[model samples]
Target: MNRTPEDRIVELGLVLPDVVSPAGSFQPSVKSGPYVYTSGQLPIVNGKLVMTGKLGQTVTTQQAAELAAICALNALAAVRAEVRELSRVRRIVKVVGFVTSVPDYSDQPAVVNGAGDLLTEIFGRAGTHARSAIGVVALPRNAPVELELIAEIAD
Candidate 1:
């Protein structure tokens, strides 16, 4: 039997967390046609932000990268909440990551790679997608990293 995406996630020693409630009026994810778009997800676990601070300052690059992975995981949870099954995903279309950084920090790509690598590990080739990593002065709830995803789903 083929290993499902959830199984791959489990094999990697990660459990997808429950879909987080929207902080504001916006929905966590929306499905349109064959696509599902997730709102930007913070590095929150168990209803709390896991880490906060500006990268290259209180938060190191490595730490921010790990937080980015958590944000990706949350984004996946949002996707699953909408589609009701990970196996329904046809492919990850795109990823947009935001990193809060101190002045002069320029390693945003490496930080967001934490998410990209995890997606590839779980979904194999389908996980590969176009991506944008942006650096900002701050983010909602003071999260160091946030991630959003666009995925294509099967009919």
Candidate 2:
């Protein structure tokens, strides 16, 4: 029996959170042709941020990494909202992560691995994708991390 992405998520002991409503004029995700582009997703749970602070200041690398994973969950929620099913995703094409941190910090990749690792666990090889981890001055809601995902979908 073939397992679907939703099944894989359950097997990995995770659940997709409710999609965060767009706070701006943009849609949470837009599907064009065979791809879905998502807006940046924050580490929110139950309609609130999990934490707020700069990564190298009040937040530790580990904490930021965990938050990155949460952002991935929110990203998945956005994809589901667009495609109507997790299994519709053929593969994750790319992930762009932004971390709010003090100027001197330079461990962005380690923080982003949290999301990549979880994605792999949930989607297997399909989760693997190109990624960029960027350090920024700040993000919306003062979130420690934010992530945007691009996925190729099936018809």
Global local distance difference test of model 1: 0.93
lDDT of each: 0.93, 0.94
lDDT by residue for model 2 (1-155), tens: 98988888888888888899889899989999999999999999999999999978999999999999999999999999999999999999999999999999999999999999999888889999999999999999899999999999999
Misplaced by over 4 Å in model 1 are none
Candidates in order, TM-scores: namely 0.98, 0.97
Runs in model 2 lying further than 4 Å from the true structure: none
Which clashing pairs does model 2 show?
none
Separately for all candidates shown, the number of backbone clashes (residues 3 or more apart, or on different chains) is: 0, 0
Model 2 Cα shift for residue 70 (angstroms): 0.6
